[model samples]
Target: MSARSGPRRPAGLGATTRAGLKPAIFVTLVSVLAVVVAAIASAPFRSSTNVESLLFQMAPLLLVAAGQATVILIAGIDLSVGSMMSLATVLAASGSAFGNSAVAVVAVVLLVGAIGGLANGLGVLSGVNPLVMTLATMAVFRGVALLVLGQPGGSVPSGLLTPLTNVYGHVPLPFVVALVAIVLLWFATAETRWGRSLYATGADERHAASAGLPVRRTILTAYLVAGLFAALGGLALVARIYSGDPLVGDPFALDSITAALIGGIAVTGGRGSVLAVVPAVLLLSLTDNLLNLFGVFSYWQYVAKGVILIVTLWGYHAAGSPSGLLAMARSGWRARDARAARGTKA
Candidate 1:
């Protein structure tokens, strides 16, 4: 071998970084495409109100998906978010006299949500499968929410609206919240030791435990975070509609999970980012907004949304897998070689 010949040190990290980025990049492209298509199909989408409306609608889904991604990153799932949100709305609206202080109301709602989430973690730790445990909790929470409201006519304090939904002086409240959630979640997953432990535990529980990582604590933390965010979604709803409705958050269970998956948060666990879910949520919002502008029926929108999710998940598996990435690398190598050979002949 030549004296200077050696394996490139950065090459391995480069390959892994590229591989890790594939899903997020794909989702970003898809989001851009969705926006462009929406703009083209519906001229009204270019209007300021319409554009800002999309941002407002994107916030709740972003929060729920962010929370779900955290739990999924630890190889667990929370099926109770929809119910959690519903319960939050009910609690905030069920005449809980906090004496004109929305802060007090918010604190109580958040606390209850964290408690519910902790219960889910406990149930899982007690040998119950998360699928079953969270599902049961969902039913229980939904029943409690119903009992709290019995219907959808409870009143929410109007003062809470501004903090939750107001776009004042060029700064949208919901957008600010979304940005904060993205930054915090990203930092936790990418820059912190706990984040590393989350991935390790999700990747393989036995290995994570053998390595002396606190796998159970990580999972518990994920659930607590998920619950808190779910309640925040309810708070957003109160700001928007200013009333409690039991059914308001029912679709979030499926929608949030779909957003996380489409956002590049792999359902297989240990491999995805919360940052990706933000744009994924935008894609969904744009799709729905454009469909509405085009006079599409709600039923058709549901079908279209399902199709989009299925296709995105298929793409994730196809282009984000090890074999798929290896194939891409080989293709690049062949092209490079072909270019070099042509140059030599020239």
Candidate 2:
């Protein structure tokens, strides 16, 4: 008697994956259109320097979004990701305090992230709401980050950061890292058994458990993965700035969630595609780059992001759900059938 043989197994999981891909595909097409339009309309936006800048900007956000999406897939959220990122940067920059060994700092940062994630998971298992538990950890992690660095003043070895900036024909190392993260995560969520289990657990926890899935472990793993990715994002940020800032990651918590949602991840969980996040990140990074090229005030970029987020959310919901493209298609078919029936009667 395997979990797959359980009465809970149905056609929904396969449909869910396909449904999620619809929004991802839509976002990808839109992202491509945006790139083309921006390049055609603005010379600077298409320049080599700006292209590099956009890629650099997209790298860290993509990493963080990957982690955020993992948590979201399991019907959970990790608000502390931003704080975890902030903590990672400070820890990495504090290598001087830890015998100036980069490896030790990196190891410590990852460890802290794992511990933080595990704590969140354990709290959730103890009946704490995921939102409440992560919110509390968010404050705690930020506090620890501040206490460690107090401000943006620690340095990373230039030697280590240089390779991250190396560009081969305009493809920076950071962007390559982001691409790798995307591929690996896409594989995990799409091909692995654990990945399928994640969707199951998220879709219906009680049924997933009855089907013999390790519901508790799945939840824990999701948070742990998120923490590690946030840490990786923080490391990427360090490569960008060559220093640590306790406040730098403050925007990431919301931004990652925005990207995930915009990319087609349902807020309710178990109903989105990780692959969709790439275009969502690209669109966001492009919007910022284009805004700068057009000389828009920095504050207005926030307004623009908010507007885009609202429009996408409204559009997705109106269609049906986060996984609404499939639903929209089905509705279209039914409507066509109705129209044909009416015509025949006439």
The predictions' CA RMSDs to the true structure, in order, are: 8.6, 6.9
lDDT of 2 by residue, 1-346 (tens): 1223222223445555676777576668878999999989999887898888888888889999988998888878889999999998898888877777667777888899889888988888899999999999999999999999999978775555667668878778878988898879877876677787887777556656766888899899888889988988898888778888998998999999999888888665666888788999998988788888899999999999988787776666665563323333444534533533343344
What's the TM-score of every candidate structure?
0.85, 0.87
| Residue-by-residue lDDT tens digits, candidate 1, 1-346 | 1001111112332332244456778778988988887777777998878877777777778888888888877768899999998998888886447665678888888998899889998888888988899999999999999988889978766666557768865445876786797779777776676776776666556555766778789888888988988888877767666778877888898889888877766564656777788888888887788889888887888888888777776676677342222323443534533533343344
Candidate 2 runs further than 4 Å off: 1-15, 318-346
Where model 1 places Cα greater than 4 Å from the true spot, the runs are: 1-20, 169-171, 322-346
* Predicted model with the maximum TM-score: 2
